[model samples]
Target chain A: MEKVMAFTGDEIAAEAMRQINPDVLAAYPITPQTETVQKFSEFVAEGRVSTDMIRVESEHSAMSACVGAAAAGARAMTATSANGLALMWEIIYIAASYRLPIVMPVVNRALSGPINIHCDHSDSMGARDSGWIQLYSENCQEVYDNLIQALPIGEDRNVLLPVMVCFDGFIISHGTEGVAVLEDKVARNFIGEFKNIHSLLDIDNPVTYGPLDLFDYYFEHKRQQVEAMEKAPEVVKKVGKQFGELTGRFYGLLEDYHLQDADLVVIAAGSTAGTVKATVDELREEGVRAGLLKIRTFRPFPQKEIIQKLSKAKAVAVMDRSASFGAIGGPIFLEVRSALFEEQKKPLVISYIYGLGGRDTGINQIKQVYHDLAKAAQSGKVSQLVNYLGVRE
Target chain B: MKLKGWKDIPWGGLILEAGNAQKYETGGWRTFRPIWHEDKCKQCLFCWIYCPDGSVIVEDKKVKGFYYEHCKGCGICAQECPFEAITMEEESKFRKDQGGRP
Candidate 1:
């Protein structure tokens, strides 16, 4: 009952845009993300999808245009990469504070200093606490599938925050993989139509969109934001269930591969998670009780689920493609530690920074992480809380 | 314990009647003013460099003056002075000629 086609992840994203058929498409061109906008531009050229693609000057304007469009009661989609995301950071917070359900596909890449155009999670990591729901994709399939899932999760009545789908740049964005795209009618029916509960463009009912709140009411508004975020897990679970029913593919806040009855576990996110799973499979063949915990949603962090999963393991290795300088560990590591703090028996969690600056992290390094985790579990003490897995110097 | 007359209320015990008024004071506030000690001032221009609102003025390797009208009282110039020359003080006592509203 589904239409299947052999498509790459980028093509899948482009076709997903066609299927979703947003009213406004605003994004700037950046590496590893250029293909998506190109394909979308072609879609606009061919008259297949009727939407207004605004070519903005900068990523800030791209997000500003998206805020305007979303406030105008339109379903909008945008694509960006590392530096572009950094430029749009201010407006990204504004979008979330305004509670606009704008969906953005972030081609995850390393933030620049020396300059690298490779896959990493640093871009999304820097924007972690910006009040948007972040969803990480492990493969080309999830990249396509999660984009479809993000709409329902974000547009739910209770949780009306923006959603960002992050896929590893060049790895999943550029790498070719087989993907199945459902028909436009099917996706449209699945995601339904955009109903604006509060729109800025409605002249019949006069209302204010975003007004400055004084000190007396500021805390209550922020508390309301937290309340909306706390309510997102229910929407995420419901949308995951509906997407599974429709697409026959299941998604969770955290997807486990052989995590049950495992002595050691390696937690990862983004495309590198696939490598971790592959290495886990090989280690299992050799009688190593190693498992993989692929994190899907990072924000509105599934803290309860993570605490339950990792509390039972002997040792856990958290692999982050980003760094939090001067902290005890990375951002994900900090959250995981806090989540497991209330539990009686907490696993020895060590944060490992890898795949930074676009360096490819193969299965060998993942095996090394597992080996180090096993050693630490055996000794019952962490030699290093944060380990740089493979670095030139 | 059960008296229910209007004069028995707590607020009704006051000596003044309801429409009676008393004089009010409106001179409790004052704006900040920056003063530079000429003896300790070396004219290093650090105050000019550090002022957030560009309220300080330095000319010809000497302290010329500063504009206190638009100063936000952020204390950046006073904190950043190398010689601790700038000190903040209340502008002056309120007077009718000094534009007191009341």
Candidate 2:
């Protein structure tokens, strides 16, 4: 039987970690993400889980240790946020290149220049091309669910890649919410035991990892990574279905809310999806045909599904919590536009950069975005293709 | 072995062997070869200790001969020999006397 409990996103993520109880956990403390490791440490102290918690000196070493552990045929996991993720950038690529099947929970925070630690997508968005499967969560429940699903997806023989489960920094990480957690035996049974095809510890069959390929084979190795990424969606769906059967909560690449007959839709990710859904409900009550498409898996982006759903709308607004400076719009917007380019009948797609540096995205501000989308639907022209929401001009 | 294609290579370009230096034949790269004098009045083994590649063959604590298959003919052994027990000979000259070596 499942247990219902209230936990902050970080605490729930730690709960999921406790349930999975990976072989190794190498992590460093960074705000928002720190509590996850802290809570997991308490689990270790209480002797609840036998995870070999490695207190690494820095985020770089943390990820490096995870890489070493995973490569040595252990199921390894870690947690980080913002600059800690940035510090692990080099090894992040290495982890994927080696296909380590390590899972990490990333608390989404603003990357520094002004050095502010707050809710934003800049951290994970910056690593969109780092070759890891990225799963975004709307709240604590989803964070727990995503973490549970991440293991099977990444550890799938066909996928064999690292997974990043991201959620808004303070919004979800600090905010407490009710969640349904699976029993340890059932969760373990669902995840099963990790079986690495090639490991450094395989004594009989010796295999090499991270070799130097000048030009003779580098392209093909990269192509293999590409092929693995292409195979992820199917594996993700299958794993999600199995998890849903166990927990009674289904998941998909993207979540569609009231998009069936709506004329206008808003596309966003992470905790902002909850905000958009609320605004959509309020707008629907006012006789406005508003809908939402919340992206769950951002790495193997649900491009076809996004195009199919958004194609029915007369206008679409993509809200990005992170900015892509010097580009036409934010990362999510760019992907949404590119996905729509192949459609025979395209919607009036616009972008809104919002909620940067932990700025509040009130229901009123979200309603204003819906109003703008409705106006664009009526006029059939997007006067402003890209705009900033709630920013002091 | 020949690498047929990129697919033949392992992911992340890992070389698993502890020392694969033997797979590469360094002898062909030599412009000069080191020739050892059997009776140089001393067997100090300085050349064996200083050799970058473990090409120097030592038997019963005595300088035996060079494993020419792996030696690059860098002349380091000839230069490091304390009693001038080794000399660097031009490859062309050494080729003519190759029959004299075991």
The ten-residue window of minimal lDDT in model 1 chain A covers A211-220
Off by over 4 Å in 2: B15-102
Clashing pairs in 1: none
Worst 10 residues of 2 chain A by lDDT: A208-217
lDDT of 2: 0.91
lDDT by residue (A158-243, candidate 2, tens digit) is 89999999999999999999999898998888888998878889987677777666566677778888888999999988988887
Top-lDDT structure, candidate number: 2
- Which residues of candidate 1, in runs, are more than 4 Å off? B1-102
TM-score of 2: 0.90
Return the number of clashes found in candidate 1: 0
User: Which prediction has the highest TM-score against the true structure?
Assistant: 2
